[model samples]
Target chain A: MKRKFFSDRDKLEPALITIFAGVFSVLVGVGLIFIVSKDPVQSVRNFLLGPLLRTYNFYYLLIAMVPITFTGLALCIIYQLKYTSLIVDSSFYSGAIVATAIGINVSLPPGLHPAIAMLAAGLVGGLISLLPAILKIKWRANELVSSLMFNYVFYFIGSFVILYYLRDRNQTILASMPFQKSFSLPKLVENTQLHAGFIIAAVFVVLVSIFLFRTRWGYEIRITGANPKFAAYAGIPVATVALYAHFVSGFIGGIGGAVEMSGLYRAFIWQMNPSYAWDGVIVAMLARKNPKFVPLSALFLAYLRVGADFMSRRGDVAFEFITLLQGLIILILASDKIANYFKERRLKRAALSHDLAAQASSAGGQP
Target chain B: MIKFIISVFSSSNYWFIVLRSTAPILLVTLGAVITEQAGIKNMALEGSMLWAALTGVIVSAATGNVWAGFIAGIAAAVVIALILGLFALKLDANAVLCGVALNLFSTGGTVFVLFSLTGDKGISSSLASKTLPFIKIPFVENIPWVGKIFSGQNIIVWISVLAVVVIHIMLNKARVGVRIRAVGENLEAAKSAGISPNRIKFLTLAVSGVLAGMAGCFLSMGYTSNFTSGISAGRGYVANAAQVVAGGTAVGAIFASLIFGLTDAMATYLQNIGLPPELIQALPYVVTILGFVVITLIRDRKELIRKKKLFEKDRAKPLASGLGA
Candidate 1:
């Protein structure tokens, strides 16, 4: 009954594109190593296998996956809603800032402290993200451009908050005061920054999936995204759905930033943009906008980050080379023509096999 | 606050700084405008500028010739745009995604190449890089007030102004411009008229590339003495917002760019008042977003009024549902 895997092209197309992009990126990665490395063979091996080579490297890779999983899941929702609002970075960073402020000033019990901080972070992230959507719905402004401008607005605002009010005179670098001891999320492993944040991120992955696939709100969101006018006609409040979609996206992203900060950082140390915004987009694209697959994609992207780091240290290539690979993958994955070509090739092969089977049946005359 | 603002505006140096800052941003704005008009969202402008800036400095340093570096920079940006064109036009890649990918590539590629070459990812200080000269207007320099504001600007600044005139004429008068507009306006219609949409888009992207190249070279070769990593510093992105505010015209780009220039100038002057430096940095972007919203609101109102007028004129006929649009 279910013999054909690509019975729906939509279902199989993303998978095919993902595989193609992965292969292309690997080839490019190897080519880069060949150009850069003195010992190409060793470097190639390290580049491919560096993240899993040792416990230390593997642990860091998991550590890197924590925040991106949050951002990635966040993006999957916004993208599902057909909004190109790139408010992830702002929300993430603002979430961190909000968490930092609370951790420093507010006093609470151990378990409740981090929870309150995260909730506040989510609120701030949601608020920051809601601006562009409001602008789009009310004034018919371009969400993409307006959201981009907001990234800058919030970045400098984050900087001002850190530099002026939260800055620690005792610290040499530009960083906020140390968060309360109770506010710190417990680390899972000794001698590593890998903390309970990963657990939270994992739980969020499930929660978001449930919210997306099981709930009534999720159904409304999907229907609205499928066709806005129809959804409106169906008595769904399209504008409200879009607003909350954006808000939830920002909320999740904000929690991610908070987790990273509360888990690893004792103070707000991000003077520059940590840039999970773009990376989240990359992860979501790789996962094909599925919340269930976000963790895997985030892990994969994290592996690349750690691999590049390990390769840089051990294989004698710069860590920044991974950025090029990311670019190449995005280029290929985003190309509809490349995806269509693969589909056409598959169809042609199927047709050829069908004809051969028919000829064999005719020759045998067994019917 | 009022007196401080007045005093700041009274200084000729303020206007001079405003114009100086406007030069590179204006070029980038112009680049965004042309591509936007050709039905292409050239998000790759930032990448083009970065590559051009990096390559221009590196090649010039290697070749021991400034002109070679300048030309090389333009070539680098053009090649990048063409690559985007090939993928987007031929392979049917999303233009915005392609641009974003290329920007990512440029970020890593430039640094990777830089570290490989000079063993420094931050700045290419080891190489004997040359800077483009400033041009002092002969008669204008002798004037009392106007001289200080207009004269002694970077050569790129003058070229940027001249480019304003050139782009205005090209977009309004040239046959190619008409084709570009037609293709942008309606792709099928253009194809029906025997104009290849791909060709026009490709050519427009190339011109934007050229503009980005000039802007890039200005940052490294003319604005500063050396190629500092991230010298472009999101000017290419801000240019997109400027393009929106500019209303897709060459002349409009100037006023939009000047608004940004003014904000940047005010930020610089406000430093003495002990304003939070980070807030100062954000002021221009905040203004841009505000400007973007205001313009959109104004346009929406105007369109609504026009639709109402159309409905009234056709009172006997059934009112089109598009009136609410």
Candidate 2:
């Protein structure tokens, strides 16, 4: 039940395993590029170090990192409760729709306009996400299954809203009218798309970290997640905590979506947008499910994404290869058996050394 | 609305479309049902289908043979299943997360390969991909409404029906089926009873792989003529919910699949009738959530009632003397 040695190794094991998984997967990814690309070394170089070589790519990486960090922070919160509610993806999209609706229609002061839009987005996102949580809590329905389907539902509904109400008849392509100037997120950099959304992301990253580690509600949520039945017996309201987790997560997701839509996009055009929620999933896993580490993970993922973009354009490799790498990283990190195997191996080694030392001492004393 | 409903339901073509639409969902549901019976939720059902669909399209196009594509497609899904088993069973990865990983991999991997082959990101219309043909039943084609509903459907449609029966027999009447159920119900007890859970699970996954592969191939080759990116859409995910609604039975999956099919077909039919297409599109998911909740409530209520009876019986027995002192 207790380890007599390797406590230090046990403490460092998770981080070690994570680094190993990342490096191992990247190597496999490089090998894949080798197999597929005409010039393997150049392709690998572009994939590995392309984002850092240029300022434009660096800014793009930061811009890409913004929304994912928000969603990753949300993921860190919801996943703490250990319930598989994938409503973050839906809520993130809904959040953008809400932001667009408010920004285009509701007139407000310059600052207040974007604020109100973000608040509305968060509210709508939270409400959309609550459906699955409520179903799971009240009826014992599988939240994961319900939420997966709900993503498609919300997406179609949001598109309906966009198509009917917000469509720009002047546009040749399917897209919404641009938001009012007041709704635009304040730009922070001269030649880059960097905006106040990045600052907001930073703020939430710290806030979530504090909320999780310091607050009583956070403690309750953590305990509930760790062992719901035990937490219930110990007087925590497990269901309530779980519900709170979903709402908070959805709020973050919604806000993130709104920020991304307003800051980076020229208009409410969704055709080019990849699901930031999935990117957030990769970020969350890369962060080892820590809110404080979300920024780091987001940056790492952003770098990979930007690198892949460069490689695809310049080195004849597909960007989709990075997605395969991301999936590999998640699987390797989430492999409980693999992690446990390492831990077991270490413990066994420790036990054997302990036995050896004992036998040698006993022989020396007898002699 | 009532008239519209009745008119839609009254048509033999409506039933035919229902069965046809249900075929893919039912195939995936059967895939889900088998895995769920073995206490594994193959979240990779979506990924498996994607890989299969893409493989079927590309291979058939390359070989100019639909059957070759079909076999290769199924084989690809089986490989995914084996990979899932390797990570989930051998390495003790969280099966759900592993499934998610595979789904992600499949989505990206399929696109990567597709882009590599044809330099197209979305559709395979340029390729000479062959589709499975619909057969005309000579004798059954003579029947009136029944013929219209049941006869001359696509080959995969018949395979789906045949699959239902084969899977039903395999799960209910076969030894492996019993072993799988035992493993699902009580892994520890099954192991203690000398059953190898790993072996049973591997077999279950292979079967699931074949079913999901068929569903995937059906979407690309049988239902549609060409491979489109995300052709499976959310059917793979829907099958999971349907399998749950069916209570993990092959027979129950038919009715569960039909329910979704009815809603889905209604979505297609109801689009022109004053309702927004998006609303119609959203209807199936809303129905699924409702069905999921209602079934859970029913099951929970039944459990509560059964527990109350046991409690009452226990209360009727003589109480032991106080032992607190």
**Model number with the top lDDT:** 1
Give the residue spans of candidate 1 off by over 4 A.
Answer: A1-13, A314-316, A346-367, B316-325
Looking at model 1, residue B3 earns an lDDT score of 95
Compute DockQ for each candidate against the true complex. Answer: 0.69, 0.71
- After the best TM-score superposition of candidate 2, give how far the Cα of residue A19 lies from its true spot, in angstroms: 1.8
What is chain B's TM-score across the candidates, in the order shown? 0.95, 0.95
Indicate the residue-level lDDT of B103 in model 1: 86
lDDT of 1 by residue, A211-283 (tens): 9889988778888878999999999999999999989999999999889988989888886987888888888
Cα lDDT tens digits, model 2, B125-231, are 88899888888898888899889988878998889988999999999999888899999999999999899999988888888899999989989997888888778
Q: Write candidate 1's Cα lDDT for B195-276 as tens digits.
A: 9999999999999999999999888888887777767787887888898888889999999899889999899989879887
Record all residue pairs in model 2 with backbone atoms less than 3 Å apart, i.e. clashing. none
TM-score of each model, paired residue for residue:
0.94, 0.95
